[model samples]
Target: MRRLRCPYCGAVFEVPKGAVYAVCPYCGTTVVAKTGEEATRQYYYPPRLDDGEAFLLAVSRARMLPGAPADIAETASLARSELHYLPLYICSAEAWVEGCEGAREEREETWLATSRLPLPGLEHGYRFPVVGREPYDPRRARRGVFHQPDASPEPRCSALRARVEYRAAGEARLAGCRGSVESRAGLVGVAHYPVWLIEYHHPLAGQPLRAVVDAVDANLLYLEYPIPLERRALVLGGAALVLGTGLAAAAAVGLAAGSLAASILGGLVGSAVAASPLLATGLSRTGRYRYRPPRVERLFIKG
Candidate 1:
């Protein structure tokens, strides 16, 4: 490994041997090590939330969940709060197609860079900031842990160009009759995005609950809260009551109608109709309670 000073920020950082691109941690500048050396502008999203604000938001979210204890927001303790800066590469492409009818130009499309720890939200339609990003400052660097990219930017940049070109060409072809298409990849740069990993304790839960929040927008990406026992028991008790009443109604209907089919139909309808509310509540509570998968839980807390 060798260390080099960033011409723009004057921050000295290390790069692996034979690496084609190195991103400056302090300034978000990328240095190209190709024949004609070059530098690309990069930016980092500033975090709008602090640990206290994030914890409050988490508690608010937890309290809003169905079957959550009413006082969870007040009683919950903030166990941990960490800010993380995830890296991304931004790439764009422009394509034009010419056909017998006319020529059309497809709008420029962009592909954001991905990393090993891009996290779940990025892949599941979580849009990263395309605007309102600020240039990295030394003071900002001290705010959180700026994760280093696992791989050089060259590979991701290349992949981005390829992906954009292919997608643009495909869209152009689909828009009109197959024609000659010209596509060119545009600027590729690096960015560090901010996120918050928060862990909190609730008396209802066995362990600390984890929440992933977007530091840029102060939005919750992921959260987990336990269902209050009283709520669950109340729902179950209502269900039982409805079920018993339905059974009695079924017997009455059968005795009045004097038919087995009528009795069965009455029983099924009564049970379903009377218990619909409780049944729905139970299903919803159980489903939401079971929503936290161990893998995802570990990813946010342990990863």
Candidate 2:
């Protein structure tokens, strides 16, 4: 076992070099990962909520939102809540993106423009203001039985850095220049964010509600629940009204312009657009529980 020193109590202890974070045995303080380059340390807050508490926490917060169904907390059934810890490498880096202006016009020459953009989905690319390699707050030691985080049997970190860099470059490229961008990490550390996948059956409509909650702060990152039948009707009706109005206007304009084919085509296209939304809404309401995906970004929280 390799020996690592605890910055909090100044105690030297044995730990695996590959271990990113560990609780200091001497002081009971959480020790965050340190790059081999630095003498200083950092911190990460693990899931204070335990497996047994997972379902309870989710239930308690289910209907807490301002517009939540009144019976969501009281009558909604908590079908299941599973624990997952998603891996992320949080880093502070120096990145410079260099891409020639797609078409830059000088004072007397061509054209130039640039812009900035991007981030990722709910479950994945969770951009928290979270930091790494910091000291653990001793006062944060709360009582709970934390389960071992589920680890993928396959390798994952192999391409993590590359993926991060690729995203960084893509951001620059999207801003309007087509060129190469490179990033060098000054400090990089891994942390697993705690998440809970909770399944619920809403009481009002008895529709299924799927939710993903951030176990760390109990943030409801994503939720898909039934829209009440009344609300569904409103959506369908409003969509139809809007589509009819738009098509009527288009058809009138085409007729005034003496184009029968244009008017007919516009009406047909409008009819299809009007049908699509209602079809989706109808399909969702077909079963006892509405068809819905639990999370916005399927790859984010689970992975």
Candidate 3:
């Protein structure tokens, strides 16, 4: 038997052994405890950190960026309003590669290259745990410390599984030489990973950009790019018109000069013109606002 807490109404009750689903007594919500082959993993919230301490730590982490917003202090202050442990699923897998050697032989002043390579096979698998939805509530009590929510356990786990599989396949392709190899795979139990959810309100863009930072590993999982509407329109639109005109001119010049030379120049110019907007959009996401976790003590206090 397991004790389950209702996310909607905050009711707690024991789920009987062999029972796969339970109806919430307070809210009448049907909560599924298991799905097919996946079993639900339990999670416990970490003890809240002191307000001053959390704020200092967040600020320190915020400083690692080269061009973080100037009012990061105020943004960090707003974080104090809510805090809760967020759940996440984590996994790691090993990858191996093997292959053959190629050699060259010279005889009678003639060079000959002999290459014999065996096809390589890669074997890897990922395990994931289902995390129930209770811990995802943004309004959960923080026990007086700043608590930033972590990734939803289900989605994060799903994404991690996909990443592990995709990376294994990609690594195999990159290693041209091939042979059979084996690797270890591991999965982490349900746990609340620390994160700093930074919401940025920029002057140029209407909506704020959200960024997630891993608390323990200090890795950036999700980051939104800030798009400057006016700048994008001007730069992109102007570049397109200019590049188009240049291509037209080159085509005309090629017809007058030589068809072959003009065609080569136009093709090069056209390819560059086509690739410019993508490069510009990539560059525009540089300036973003930063948010960090708040102190636990301050969150529970009434304003």
Candidate 4:
């Protein structure tokens, strides 16, 4: 037996074993029922840590310069974090459409449709499969409370329907397969993923830096760092020295023999000087950082 909550009347009801669909006695809404086997086989992600603490851990590791800021440390220490389980929906369907191309007067028109026909007596069908899994592991605990599913199933299903509509309009053969509208294939469900959030103290300044990563995926999400005014000046001065020295050498060579070697040497020096700023800019944009428990491992759900 399984318990069901009515979407229309908010009534609760007990569904008999093996029942697929049940009609709400009070509100007349058709609710799909899950089987005992299906209910027991679903996999869930366990919550590891609260959002605020996770954020702090991440930021601490995202190396800020020495003597950064006091405010940065305060902000990192006072932030909040949240945990959630999002849902992902999947579907398989047949699509048909009509389209046209060319000029209006002598336009070419075509009607195209493909169907698997569902094997005569087979009715419309839907199946939800477990694709990728994200588990929360705050302390590397062997057991923990799994986060409840929070994402609505309807929107996910609607996206899938839109994809089917779009596919039907395109010039392609519809084969037997499962698909999603905006997400990657083989990702049928978007279950809630875990993440660690961190705020780190900047020693020089009074401000803190923010960082986030997928606890399960170990994918870094955000990072921010500032470059010192002195470093910027140093880069500019170095570039000027490289350019001026090269130009002076080239002039000397021209006065001596007007040789190709002088031109080649000048060009190389000029290119290096011109490219220095770009390299420095790239480095400044990507600030220094590190993470603990660094290996990324994919989680798979068997149920």
Candidate 5:
């Protein structure tokens, strides 16, 4: 085993022979065992939420769901709450195409979260505002689980380099010249982002529903909430009313026009149109619980 000290926290840990990376158990910093200059440093974002605050936010988000019980915020029981630090790799690359006349330069950046766990709503295009990032510290984690990076950052950095080179080549082509690319990956860093996994239960939902929130920004990422009986009844009643009214209107028109065919066609059209919305609603809220965010937006740290 090779022993390596974490650059950010100075915690010494051992990695298997020929291993590339290992996360420091003390500070949760992913340290590279080799490739000194090419390796990226690791940092973490401090969590802005506490246990009580995270649970309250989850309850509030649940109450905001469509057809949610009015008393859910008051009556829901907090079952479990867990804090986790997920790893995200930030890779940047810049390329310059050397042409006969001039050179064209292009840059590319990408953020990739490399957790194999079943975390929902954590995908590419989710931007992390590069602010308030400090050196990884276990004390600041507040007893949260520091999930190790499941994948390496090299592939992502390579992809970024390819993108930069492609863009540079395109620019050279537009300038009426073919060129060769000179590209290098830059600023390869891993950031451990804080997340809250909250579970709550209400009598209406039978089972506990989970909510994932960004601890730094308090933005709800994923949510599962119970559907209120009142809303379900209202939807059913409205559908019935619309169906009956349309059938009556169709029958009246048929009687006025003295044509059964027109009545049948009108009724069919009316039924299809009226049922479409209701069917969609029902399908979306198929079970007692629904998984969706009320007002979703990009979650990032305050600059």
Candidate 6:
């Protein structure tokens, strides 16, 4: 047993010799008796939306997007929702890359590539414009009732992120140089980002559409779009009608010229021209779906 003296009250107490940290029993003062690398603190931003509000927000978003079925927000029921803290690699380092000219190393260019980590299958594909955010200490996270995601990034994911970081550094260094460049990463650490996962079923889409929302500001980051049955049917019918017309015209022309092969070729061309409408529609829909503005871009439904 070792006697520990309270710095605040000067009260002496006995604690296990192996204990690294303990609280003073008399004055409720914290004491640290160990030395080494300090542990990194995890944090979680308080979510504005609870279970109910999150569901409503998702529905409202659904209603605004074009091509979304009318009353989908109201009619579509939420099947499942998840709130989790996604880990990110917050790197603060500089790369010393070698800038080469022709076949020789020209000079050393120190390039700062990027710090934000990637959350694949999530917003911006990679973390973009990840600035200005306040986080609460995870140890005191019980200030509000919110779910914490238990899933963590595996070791392989860390390796992938490191590769991305190095590649980005190399590309940046090369871009600044004329011929070639070499890059290496430095300081990096693990961080956490909070997100809301909402899964709901709508009539238009046979499967559920998953929407990933930013828990802090309630912004929709990534949404899986689905095409309705009616649209699919229309696209198919329209394409078939045009193709059939093209084939018939080609066949007729070929028969008149006494060449069976010519007729087949003409039919193919006719079908393509007929299907132009479908192509145009598809392109238009694709452009709209990629629109990122929450207010301006009404809907982003993808089939």
Q: Pick the candidate with the highest lDDT.
A: 5
Between candidates 1 and 3, the lDDT winner: 1
Q: Give the clashing residue pairs of candidate 5, or none.
A: none
For all candidates in order, the CA lDDT equals 0.64, 0.48, 0.41, 0.41, 0.68, 0.49
TM-score-better candidate, 2 vs 6: 2
Tell me how far the alpha carbon of residue 162 in candidate 3 is from the true structure, in angstroms, after superposition. Answer: 15
- The prediction achieving the highest TM-score against the true structure is 5
Model 2 ranges off by over 4 Å: 1-80, 95-126, 131-183, 204-208, 215-219, 227-231, 263-278, 286-303
Query: Residue-wise lDDT of candidate 3 within 84-191, one digit each (tens)?
Result: 233333444444434422211111110000011110110111111232223322244233222212223344334444555444444555545445544444443333
Total clashing pairs for each candidate: 0, 11, 10, 25, 0, 4
lDDT of 2 by residue, 4-90 (tens): 666667777665555555445544443553432222333445765664465555556544432344455566667766655443334
Every model: Cα RMSD to truth: 10.1, 12.7, 17.8, 17.2, 7.8, 13.2
Better of 2 and 5 by lDDT: 5
Model 2 weakest 10-residue run by lDDT:
106-115
Error of 3 at 265 (Å): 9.1
- Between prediction 4 and prediction 5, the one with superior TM-score is 5
**What would you estimate as the lDDT of candidate 2?**
0.48
Q: Give the worst 10-residue stretch by lDDT in candidate 4.
A: 103-112
**TM-score of every model?**
0.59, 0.45, 0.33, 0.33, 0.65, 0.42
TM-score of 4: 0.33
Which ranges in model 1 have alpha carbons more than 4 Å from their true place? Answer: 1-39, 98-115, 118-125, 139-142, 151-179, 205-207, 232-303
lDDT of model number 3: 0.41
